[model samples]
Target: MSNIIQRIEAFSQLGQFLSQFTTERISKKEQVLHNDLFFDAFKMQVERAQEFNGWFTLDNVLFSCEGWSKSLTNENLNKFIDSINIKKNTPKTIAIIMAGNIPLVGFHDFLSVLLMGNSVVVKQSSNDKHLLPILAKYLEYIEPSLKGQITFTEEKLENFDAVIATGSNNTARYFDYYFGKYPSIIRKNRNSIAILTGNETDDELNGLADDIFRYFGLGCRSVSKLFIPKGYNFDKLFNAVFKYKDIINNAKYANNYDYNKAVYLMSLFDLLENGFLMLKEDTSYASPIASLFYEYYDDSNSLKEKINSDKEKIQCVVGNGFIDNEIAFGQTQLPTLLDFADGVNTLEFLNNL
Candidate 1:
């Protein structure tokens, strides 16, 4: 059996391997173990992922790789591991149902299960099926004892003690019905929001633009709605976010922008647009692609109370000390290992199981 030290070292090495594929460039380093065998293969997989899923552009995939590389360091992994208690018991198999909204979105769950000395059976989203398997192969190569511990399947899952599933609200209902008897963590629809005061500087607003536009605003961590002062100026935000105006060049994104704009205009709805993005006054949390929704808040106390009331529907609150547990302006998409989704402690759940 592989001990905790070996597991952590293997993951740390995997992090080192991922460091080569950042958004700046994909350079090969001779120091990386097995690079002669795996580097070119992984690079091809990245390109293949972009070709298969239109939303998975090459740069966005590299950005995801960059975030994971920064997160999977020796210091960070050790800190996360030391925070939890691992028992010496027989290992069990954990089933993971992943979401494909962004590249490698479900990797944290996969890492949690394996690091806790449990085997994993993963059912990947078709939209993201190309990347993780190759990485898993690399892990097995680095740690031979990890063989036979990981499995990927397309068939119905069976013989698993617990499950971690993420999907939309409708699929969550089915997962609840099927996996209810087992110890499970079932995640449903959730969106992130931002609270803006008129006092934001240009740099902070630019970071806010990243929170809204990265991954084309598809991830749950992406800010889809805003709570602003009653008489806020939109010009500051528009000017800051104009740096991302090139996003309109992507055909899929442009199609959504044009279609949604047409619908809003035909319905005679009031809107503010700057040719690339649109701002609509909506109370809903989930906004369409290329559109942002905003609401007016009269007082901070009432806004905080309302947010607390709707905490379950919210994933991140990007602000500058406006509330407890708020994320900084541009840090939503660059979550660390400890930033568990839905505010649930995945390691704690695995430990108890």
Candidate 2:
């Protein structure tokens, strides 16, 4: 088999192994590669992931795993990398500094670097330290040639040809100062928003709920704010998303809800609530946990222009025909391989390097 084909097959096998752990729970499937060797161990890793990071609930962890399983199919893999040439040469080392906001949050960058025929040195966030390493081990065992291409470090990174770092606005400056000389992709805080036209169906609004509450609104693609027509009532939205009211049962989410609600009440900020989510009027793109910010739009055209002008602060805009290349409502988290983060093509960047 060719080098790239072997690598791709390794990833595909990893995806099939991960598909067993879905939103339901982790289960062992017969005939999977390495199932006899690693199945029990990986299940333990899933539990360990949540124990290390309270935000990495089993459901969310499995959700992330399922998404990758679907994306790593042969067809999707071919489509994502076919346009970008990767030669079998001495590959450069790409150091990646990953965020821990959600489960397997940095896998795409890791996958990108590997698919570009480069070695990766990863520094993972302490909050998300367990799962990816186990998956990497599975990959190495599947394709022995990949044995030395992946490395994980807890110490400071060194001796890398390029870098890709994801962090908050504050950490981004630090990365820029440190990695400015290297060919790098340093991502800062970016939040998604939903544009409501007062004509959305109940199902669409429910889908929007998935976008908002999937990762407890921690992902860059999570909708933190909303743009609604002037004088539009939020009753329908609240009703549509009410089915997700069980989210309040989670202690962390409940604490955030109670705390933010108390703060809003103490400060006399006028807001809307539905026993779980709080909607406050604000202009910010990034909202706090358990709270969503909203703004009034007088004209759709003007709103489109505003969103266009502030594209850097935005990630995915969820709406129907609201703007060019807008993400459909509720599909923000279901990003395809071609849906590169920050609209920057990672393969192209690695090829150039």
Candidate achieving the largest lDDT: 1
Off by over 4 Å in 1: none
Residues 14-97, candidate 1, lDDT per residue (tens digit)? 999999999999999888999988999999989777688889999999999889999888899989988887666678899999
Q: Tell me the TM-score of each prediction against the true structure.
A: 0.99, 0.97
Q: Candidate 1: minimum summed lDDT over ten consecutive residues — where?
A: 81-90
Clashes of 1: 0
| Each candidate's clash count | 0, 0
lDDT of 2 by residue, 166-254 (tens): 99999999999999999999999999999998999988999999999998999999999999888888999999889889989888999
Candidate 2 lands at a TM-score of 0.97
Report every candidate's CA lDDT: 0.93, 0.90
